[model samples]
Target chain A: MSDHKILQYPKSPYLKTSYYEDTAIQAFDTPFRKKCLVIGLLFWVCFPFVASSYVVHIANLSAIAAIGAMSLNLLIGNTGLLSLGHAGFMGAGAFTTAIMTVQFGLPIWIVIPASGIVGALLGLIAGLPSFQLKGIYLGLSTLAIHHIIKYGCSEYQYYGGFGYGIVLEAPSLGPLLLAGKTVWFFVLWISAFATALLIANLLRSKPGRAWSAIRDRDIAAEVSGIDIGFYKILAFVVSSSLISMQGSLYAYYTAVVSVEEYSFGLTVSYLAMIIVGGLGSVLGSFLGALLITALPYALIILAGLVDLSFAVKEHFSVIQTGVFGMVVILFLLLEPLGLVEIWRRVRCYFELWPFSYKPLTIIKR
Target chain B: MLLASIVVLAGIYALLGSGFVIIYKASRILNFAHAEIVMLAGYLAVSLAVAIPFSAASLLAVLCFCFVLGMSIYAILIRPLAGYSVLSAIILTVAVGVLLNAVGVFVWRGEMEVIPFGWRTYFSLPGNIRLSSIEFATLGIVTLFYACMGLFYRFTKIGQQMRATAENPLLAAQRGISIYRISGIAWGIGFAAAGLAAFLLGINYAISLQIGNIAVAAFVVALIGGLDSLLGTIPAAFIIAATEQLTITYANPRLGDAIPFIIMLMVLMFKPWGLLGTKEELDRV
Candidate 1:
């Protein structure tokens, strides 16, 4: 059933592997994957000098979003559990890191990991209900967490009073000053890459396979002796930890925290990134993050081209909100698999070149 | 005064919550955009009052206009999207909300406006339980609406069809019921109730493009009451309102919004199903 004429390709003159040998069918177990990782690392090392300050800022935002998106992917894409309150978990991490650093004068290293630990603890607590519930009930359960975080941060006097004022000093790792755009860019990328690596490895492990099994068929997985509850909680914890790390990095980058920044809208945006990128792929996470993060800037530039009156410019947020909604709907209707899937198809086409033929059975049954 | 306020808030929430239950039961969709519908109706009411002279005639006109708006939304958006996944429906409703918000901004120019309703002396009980005439009217109207809805569901064939649809869409369809028609009716009723609630809210507070903020409060009320139980919504609404009032009166007023959320979390942790919802009903979701 999986066989197709499009699987064939003209032999590469320079390489031993024939196009007919099914390069696409080869499992992701080549030294090429390692070389790709090395190149990615080299690019990051050189990013500080090669990229402009503004590009570095954008990269930082994408990295932070990637971390959060990766966490969400574990729950939604892998475990088939929906979370509407991921921003809340991120907020928990951010606020924890911020409060510790600002109030107790904790070191940067201590605060960052502390943020992840706090996030993981909160994730586990929040995820407990999933052991007993499924579907919309579980979704609402997570939503309740979001509201709780929002309310707690806004009203609870321990963090800051309900006026929504919370601020933190940027951190410095001893002699290595980790503030400004340069340091933020590197820190966020490192965090994102670490998260991606962890997710990749987890996906290849037993727990990851269990999560997929649960996602595909929970009853079958449970009947097969897989502990559904354990894997669900594990996914939630790992996802939450990554989100918290992102949150900590965000807090340190901006040196401030506001309840408004972690609203349901941010959660929606994160969901959009994953959905638009390709739900289960690591490449999809980064692609969705970069595209979504850049979309608003592109809109702003486009809006600038039109000679709008000052009054209209002030109301630009309304326009932006409308555009955001339109974009989400368009993607939902036109490309639900997101950009990564599209990128994969394009790569496959180019790789096959002259011998490529339409795959007759590629359409979903 | 506090007691009177709680009763009035309870009555209003009961009306809205019952409407939410009816719709959810029939469609199996939570209708997240219900709040946006309420805002739309409120805006329409304001427009009617402005376009026509403010009289008893104008009030009737506003109500009728809102009813039509409610029916039209069902026919246009809700009916077509029926039978899709609950998540897709949710995303669609959210999209509809965003669209409505944009329209509201354009219509109101993002300004806060007061709905003109002539006032009389504030009513009071012997124990110094003062209540505004508007509040009293709202409570009375809410009671009337709930009674009518209860009678309709118990006695009317259309109401029975709606119930059947809610209970089992496939079975209802097999029984020769038009699920679309039932859902459309549910949507209309839901929106009308939300409209009435929004009117009462606007009478007490100024209306703005951000009227959906109140919907969040309503959502918490609905969740606490249990998504399936209309009877449970009244007490849940009162509890939520009282908590907010007390938090403002005694605790820090800034914590008022957080109070409901804290209560929701506590309820969810202990009884993942809600105050009135059965575990079996929740498991299906």
Candidate 2:
């Protein structure tokens, strides 16, 4: 009992207990981290200028994927919902933007928000089943919704005489035409950054805490007076809205809205992105989006480097799918926590210096 | 003609859905890879028929191979994931399906092929309708399989042990029953059923990668019949198969693909445990 006195003493000299310390984003919590962030921002800002148009285009695509990935992570990682209908949300946004732009002649700004509203409505419908179903059952219901939405989209195209799908004019924002790789890159990456900041802050707030609580244990959360159904629906609405907005941007970027693009495969890829990135982490979402979006290009380059035979090249899509499966399996089996865990381990190894031990305390003197 | 088609389609759904139900009953995990198993069996039937001299021998070989493959999938991939969340297990099954699909594409080159077993002759029915010989074989095979399974479950010691394991795994294990072995047998039987169904489907139509979509319809069947009850799949399959046929024949051909999903959503909305599924099963999931 006397020895227990030593355990009661302050374990670390650098202990922080302020509310601000608890809620503030960890990336900017320390001076060194802030400096690293500044450097990263500078790199991000200069990337378009330094790289070619094709590279900028890829970056823009990654940024768009990053937005979708982050929103999906919010639902699956934070809320524990496991939705397989993310691509449907994105498609709804794309088609909404298409109809608003082509038929009603609405501006890009108006169309984007309209798409988000449509997404929110759809999210409500999608999330309603979550009240009664949990885990994989909820996922299946979302999948059913996805197929329904896909059918509706295709039927609209078929009836509207756009058999090939609707193509839109380059979107203009007021005086400036929002075309070309450079301008869209800025628009997209900035939106991605804003989304990241928004989600990071949201995760620190009451709703975010409620979402995590529900995700960890809904019945326990219910016992603690949390409205389980409300939070679950809120998660779907928010996630779908963001993903739909990204879809709007995607439609504008590609200048096309087609049902073929929003297949079940697309939803699987986004799921892969969040899972591969680091489920609940914002930075992990960005990393995962970048990695998965670039996987095909990376595979092509790798195939070129290896000088593979023409037979393998002919079946490249098949090989790509096989590799995708292998990557997901390896990640789930070996590193279930994802690329973010790898980054944390590397940071820990460097931060710990010559001491080859993991610190038991959160803070060190 | 409509009745004959409905009967044949229902038989196919019953075979596949019962496979899904058995697996879920044993381990409480949804086997998303069941579709891939069906696809693989079709391909195997096509290729092995060309390689082997005897058609019946090749059919047996395919079933035997699929049984082993199913057990291997359980032992290698799914067994490790038992400790994780059910979502992870589901995702792993999807991933395995993707891998198997890629392998199938690589081996078969994604080409459509006909199964050589069935004679393509049509028998005239009493009402100016024609049923293919393959359709007759399908109905006969489905009936025989169900009858055998019914007797096996009631009388066989291994089947009784499996039933015990499914009812209460902990108590079964305490009584010196090996839960893993029972689960492996369930997977084995499930895969064998899928293989037999795929053979019938390939002979009736043509074998291709697209045949995997049949599993989605079967998935709806499993849900409608209750995921835990094997007998429930028969009526559930009839309901789904009739809905699918009616929609395709009367409503629109395009809506045929979407009809099953629409019914599933409606069922989930009103009867989440399914038409025959126990209420407690919903809470357990």
Give the number of the best model, judged by DockQ: 2
User: Model 2: per-residue lDDT, tens digit, A73-174?
Assistant: 999989889898999999999999888888899998899999999999999999999999988779889989988888888888887889787999998888
Q: Write candidate 1's Cα lDDT for A1-365 as tens digits.
A: 34565457653443556544432323334666668878877998898789889778888888888888888988887888888889899888888886787679999899989988988998898789888877777777788888778777765434455255467766788888787898788778878878888887788778888998988778999999999999999988988888987888888888878777888878878887887787777888989888888777777889878898886787777777777666766665566667886887886777678985863334320
Off by over 4 Å in 2: A1-14, A360-365
Candidate 1: clashing pairs of residues: A276-A338
Instruction: List, for all models, the DockQ compared with the true complex.
Output: 0.50, 0.51
- Tell me candidate 1's fraction of native contacts, as a decimal between 0 and 1: 0.45
Q: How high is the TM-score of chain A in model 2?
A: 0.93
lDDT at position B9, candidate 1: 68
Question: In Å, what is the interface RMSD of model 2?
Answer: 3.8
Model 1, runs deviating above 4 Å: A1-52, A156-164, A351-357, A360-365, B55-85
Interface CA RMSD, all predictions: 2.6, 3.8
Residue A185, model 2: lDDT of 91
Q: Rate the local accuracy (lDDT) of all candidates.
A: 0.76, 0.88
